[model samples]
Target: MFRQMFEEKYMRFPGGRAKAATFSYDDGVKADKRLAEIFAKYGIKGTFNLNSLLFDCERWHGRMDEEQTFLTFYNRPHEIAMHGARHIFLNKVPLPEAMNEILQNRVYLENRFGRIVRGLAYAYNGYNAEVLAALPALGVAYGRTTEDTRTFALPEDFLRWNPTCHHTDPALFEIAEEFVKRDPAGEFKHREPLLFFVWGHSYEFDDADNWQVCEKLCARLAESEGIWYATCIEICDYVKAYRSLIFSADGERVYNPSAIPVWLELRGRIYELPPATTVQFAKEL
Candidate 1:
């Protein structure tokens, strides 16, 4: 039973033990472009959460039309999703106002980018159950929250495991290399090794300490062949796929994604997948 839950927690859509780590860049534009370029070089894909209002700020930033154009260009490989209109905290505002932020932004983004915005990252990761219920009506299949207590967040249901924005944690990043190479054996022993989710603003890649830590962690993730690097969207779909398959092969399933988190056994622990599955990390062009 524990193994079943463990496999369920880490299982991706289709069903497999593979771990994936996603690289997401929020706010949009040049930094978005740079992050895409870097990930592309490594054959990885990412999710770009955009705030529609800020696109107009290109002119204000002294770029004079460069902002929107730059974002339009970089948006090619990444999935362009809504990032709330004003970055407002949903808990503080009235429901209509908060829902409008998501609905309006999805409209503006579709008009500009021509893609259906299905995923969202709550500004500041603040939300209540009421907010979640409203998303489906607004055409959002899933959204992420600001939770990273573990390497990954499991679904309360298979339909949702959207880790909105993975907070940047320096502690893990600082020792990733040392931990992966040596610790995976003893100090870092877990039946199913982690698929680390480290995130931060792409523009801040210039920060000396932050950059080094991000670089170090990325290197470790790359070196560790067991884990899969994936974006939150990819994770959601994968989890959804996994659950649906278990319930039915045709992809019709009613279940939560977090019912499974990890499995511990005499061998210690390891990830488990359902009957059939392979979580893909590439993006649509």
Candidate 2:
């Protein structure tokens, strides 16, 4: 009997690595300048969520001006995401108002940065059924919350993407230690990819006078083996591309329709499927 091992395939990050790390920080404040430098030093990437209406607005407090924004993020390997137009609690407002805030914020960012902004960080960690339902129509690919899951697991739903922990979590270092020490290939059921997502506001460091916390954390994770440090949108795009792979009838061959390449592990054999190419497998392992 010819057996089909369609269910035996597994997905990996860009370099065939099963572990990834991404960071998200909210509010465009001066502290982000230092944070950006720290991330650049470690070769890490993250997303900076900003309120479009707050930028260079005299009435707003602690918001970065256009010049400061350029100085902080221009040369950095980071992403810009919407955090509402005025940091409004989306769910508290009407659905149209929420969508308008998101759209205006996205438009302003796109105009300034010349890139389509697709990620969102809910202002005040607030959202409801209505706001969530309208995100896709407004062009948001994913939304982040303040909730912490405290584990290195990918989100089942990207819209409610809860991070592993905030940077200020008391066990931040311990959790980072766990992420670096765990081996995904050690067990069969745990063979899926793992992600360590950390989210917070850079201004929090100034309040606590603990910039060293992030400095040390970045040092701990910098250039670790088998770890793909990416921005939130990068991770989202990679996962989506991986999921879009198509399999042949017998599952011995696969096609990657997306423009991004994807890695797969089939019956313990690793394979890289380039963009728009089909790969046929050898005899059963």
**Per-model TM values vs. the true structure:** 0.68, 0.93
lDDT of 1 at 41: 57
Question: Given candidate 1, what's the lDDT at residue 53?
Answer: 63
Q: Report the poorest 10 consecutive residues by lDDT, candidate 2.
A: 1-10
lDDT of 1 by residue, 1-285 (tens): 122321122333222333456765566655455566666656566777777665546433221133554455444766777778776787678889989999988998787776666878777777788887777889886776556544444565522344423435545654354334532323322433344455556756643335554455555666675455566666666555544533334322323333433221222233243234432221211
lDDT of 2 at 276: 98
Off by over 4 Å in 1: 1-17, 56-75, 157-168, 174-194, 207-210, 247-285
Per-residue C-alpha lDDT of model 2 across residues 140-178, encoded as one tens digit per residue? 999999999998878778899999999889999999998
lDDT of 2: 0.86
* Backbone clash count for every predicted candidate, in the order shown: 28, 0
In model 1, what lDDT does residue 86 have? 70
Where does candidate 2 stray beyond 4 Å? 1-7, 56-61
List per-prediction Cα lDDT, in the order shown: 0.55, 0.86
